[model samples]
Target: MKILHTSDWHLGATFEGIGREEDHKFFLNWLIPFLKEQEIVVLIIAGDLFDQTQPSAEAQRIYYQFLLSVSQKTDVKKVIIVGGNHDSPTRLDAPAELLKLLDVFIVGGISVDGKDFSRYLCSLKNEQNAVELVVAAVPFIHEYRLGVRTSMHNESEIHSLFKEKIQNFYFDLADAAEQIAQDAPIIATGHMACRGSELDDAPQEIHMIGTMGGLPSAIFDSRYSYIALGHIHRAYRVDQSNAYYSGSPIPLSIKESNYPRYVQLISYEKGSKAKTVQKIEVPVLRKILEVKSNLEQIHSILLNISWQTPMPPILAISVQVNSYHSGLDLELKNILKNKFQDASPIIAYIRQIPAKSDNNVLASKEAFSLKELTPEQVFLKMCDTYNEIVDENLLQAFRSLLNEENI
Candidate 1:
């Protein structure tokens, strides 16, 4: 049996307000054929199926359409999807009964009691209807769900408690699987931040995940053949453990533009473990490029850049200025229009970054264009620009506001 592992599709995601509908379409178009060719029997999308909880209608359509197409067109026998931190359990679980008709197992979240272990256990059978492989279809787990917290404890102490709770949860699940399995090999899935995985580079995102953290990989039982993971945007193994993150099929940000995005193909047999693995690269259907330099350098690089995608690439241009010019933005836009008259890259962002010494001198520079950083990071930077000290209570309030919906 050949099982393909992938995660963090982030469907309906946009690059600086420019919709990525075409790129996502192209990826699905590419994926369908690959699955057929590889003759994969099980498909595992570990987490983050959509970029947001409430995805656009178009995104939802694409998702359902792809699922329908794959079921009808491919030789794949099963599809497994779990929830990520960005996913809404209710939204995904709503379609559970309907999707089962197409042989898709969607575990959006743990049960209310967190003891419904049976729902997560998926038994993969062979030609004779004999059980071959068992999967622990775990989803993204939050600290609150674990019910481990202490107001009097230090931060480190609290983390240890959470870690113990999480580890115990896995242990209970594994024990249940072991009792049920006579000979079938068991693998598992998870969507959380682990200690040694490469992370997405946005500062605020980093901070947020850091607080939730880097769960120690040692917590997982070594009994499982393979533990497919998600949440981390980078595809890598956690310090040479049985677990591995398949990462996103497409780069989510400019910082991720250079990542070698691919889904893993793992070889499995009727009675053995998931043996070997192979990476089948997913082509970047479009580009998201960022260039930061003096105007002359920026202009030169943009014109000479290589673009081998079907769609016009999304671009972020940062022009370093010694002195501010009111019309620089207009001038740059005009220049781009003239230069790439035939097919121009989409100018998603254009910001003039003055020298650090010049930050406080001009209001424009003080209110800098935000890119890549989290809202909190940008807010702190703004405070730094005005030389203001924020009290702890004020910072906490700001964080609360940041986490609020529709803000």
Candidate 2:
């Protein structure tokens, strides 16, 4: 039986203010054909199906459209989707009954009744009606939903409770899968961050709830044949190849550009203890480039950009300067427009980096005591740090509110 493992689709995500509908559509289009070509029987999307908890209507449309296409276009018999911290359990679970007809199992979250472990355990069978694989589809467990009562006052106690609850949850599911089909390979799915996983210095949000530390990889026992994980956006193995993160199908941040996006195909022969894994790289639908240089260097690079490509790359430019220069911004924008006239480059952001001397001037100020400043002064200083202008009317309103509160 062949199963394709992928995660962190993060559909409906936008790069800066620009929508990624087309990028995601391209990925889905490419994936459907690959699934058919590979004759993959089961597809497992570990988590984070949507970029946000409440996805846009278009995002929902894309998701359902892909699922419908899979059923109609591919030989895939079973699909397992688990929810991540970014997903709304209710939203993902809404089409549970309908999707079940398509042999797509969605585990949005843990059941309200904690005792019902059957929901998380599923069995996939071959054409002959024999169980070929057993899956423990565990979704993102909100720490509070784990039903562990612990003193929130003590940090160590809270971590202990969370660790215990999470370990027990998987333990129950694995136990159930074993009971159902001991011979069948038990593949487990998780949407939480695991310890020892490498994280990129990207702007992507890491969903850390309650505690900062991740669950130890040791939590996944040897009983399971393979453990598929999500949350961390980089594809890597945890402890061994048997446990791995498929990562996101597309890059979510600039730091992620260095890592190649791909999905893993796992094949297991009937009655065989070993499984073969293959990495299938996903094609880059669009380019995300981060350029860092001085103002002159940036100008030269932008002017020399080739227009041979169908579309210009989405760029994040960081130009070092002695101070903020409106001329430099205008020049870069005009150059980019002239270079790629038909398809204008999407500038994700233009960060202005003050020169060392300028930084030294700013750093020369002695650290002011917060207690010495008035509320209005503190607010103004905070706004200055971000180069934001504080409106006089808004400042007055704040002062009035402060006076009324007798502070």
Candidate 3:
């Protein structure tokens, strides 16, 4: 069976506050051709179908349009999509019966017993082979939904409780997979960071743990043919070849600038134990670029890289300017948006100030003066000013990280 594993679509997502509708459309255009070339029978999108729980009307329109376009372009027999934290499980799965008519299975949210949606079965055909595959859809399950009741008295106990809860989830998932498969080659799809996989620094971590269960090492063993995971933005392998994450097609944020964005193509033979996986980078509407430059240097770089008509919304442009250059925020934002026809550019500017000398002006010249404060110190100071309870524990952790980085 030839399948495509991809996740974290985050439809309606904005790059630096600029909508990603055009970029997503471009993805569908490339995706259809790729599927045709590979003759992919199954398309598995693990999760994060949308960037918000309640997507805007425009978001809904684009999402439905993309699905319709996919159905039109490829001979793909089945499309399985789960829900990530950013998605509204109910909304994504609202028209399940309607979508099933179009051969799309959307598993938005799971119930208390780890059963929110039905198992999907699809027949995949290659040149001289045909096989049936069963997919156990496990959407993003939060700790509360696990129905885990824990009353731990200490840190160690809390960790143990968490571990036990995770084990139960995996057990439930395994049981569900077995019941759902009913002898067909089993494939699992969900939105969770397995162990040995780096969690993309997304805002989701601020609220809930992606999933209770870490990577299941033994999942690479018998019965389960493949595990398609989401949550992490960068698609990668975790335990082994059987488990994979097809990363986000577009750069979700500036921090994701370094990762090469791509999707995956998986070719599996039912009778055989091995599978083939390929990564495909979709053509993007606008290229995301990042550069760190000082104030004196950025004007030239901006002019050199500036767009004439259509341009990618700039994000978090790091700049180094003289400390004396006060209040350039409004001017900088105007220059960027006005020229590029974007909303606003994300900024990360730093000022370069010389060390204070002995003769430097002081409120009281009774004590010795200190040299220039580093960027790390500047950040901590700002944090302190903004946050009322900048306590010692968080401060110590931040300091340790700064010291480790030699910042």
Q: What do the candidate models score in CA lDDT, each in turn?
A: 0.78, 0.77, 0.63
Candidate 3 lDDT by residue in tens digits, 6-98: 888888887545677877777777888888778888888888888888888887887787678678888788888888877888887789889
Model 1 lDDT-worst window of ten: 200-209
Candidate 3 positional error at 371, Å: 32
Q: Against the hidden true structure, what lDDT does model 2 obtain? A: 0.77
Which of the two, 1 or 2, has more TM-score?
1
Q: Per-candidate TM vs. native?
A: 0.89, 0.84, 0.74
Predictions: Cα RMSD each: 3.3, 8.1, 8.2
Runs in model 2 deviating more than 4 A are: 148-153, 198-212, 306-310, 358-407
Report the error of model 1 at residue 286, Å.
Answer: 1.6
For lDDT, candidate 1 versus 2, the one ahead is 1
lDDT of 2 by residue, 1-407 (tens): 78999998988888777788887888898999999999999899998999888999999999998999999999998899999877888899999989998889999987888769788888987678888888889887766577543323244665677677777777777788898876888999997777665434222323322234666776786788888887878777776646888888887766666667889889988677589887788886776788888888998888876533235678888777766787766788888888778677788777776555643674334334453355666888888999988874565455444433421
Off by over 4 Å in 1: 150-152, 198-209, 356-371, 378-407
Which pairs clash (backbone N, Cα, C closer than 3 Å) in model 2? Answer: none
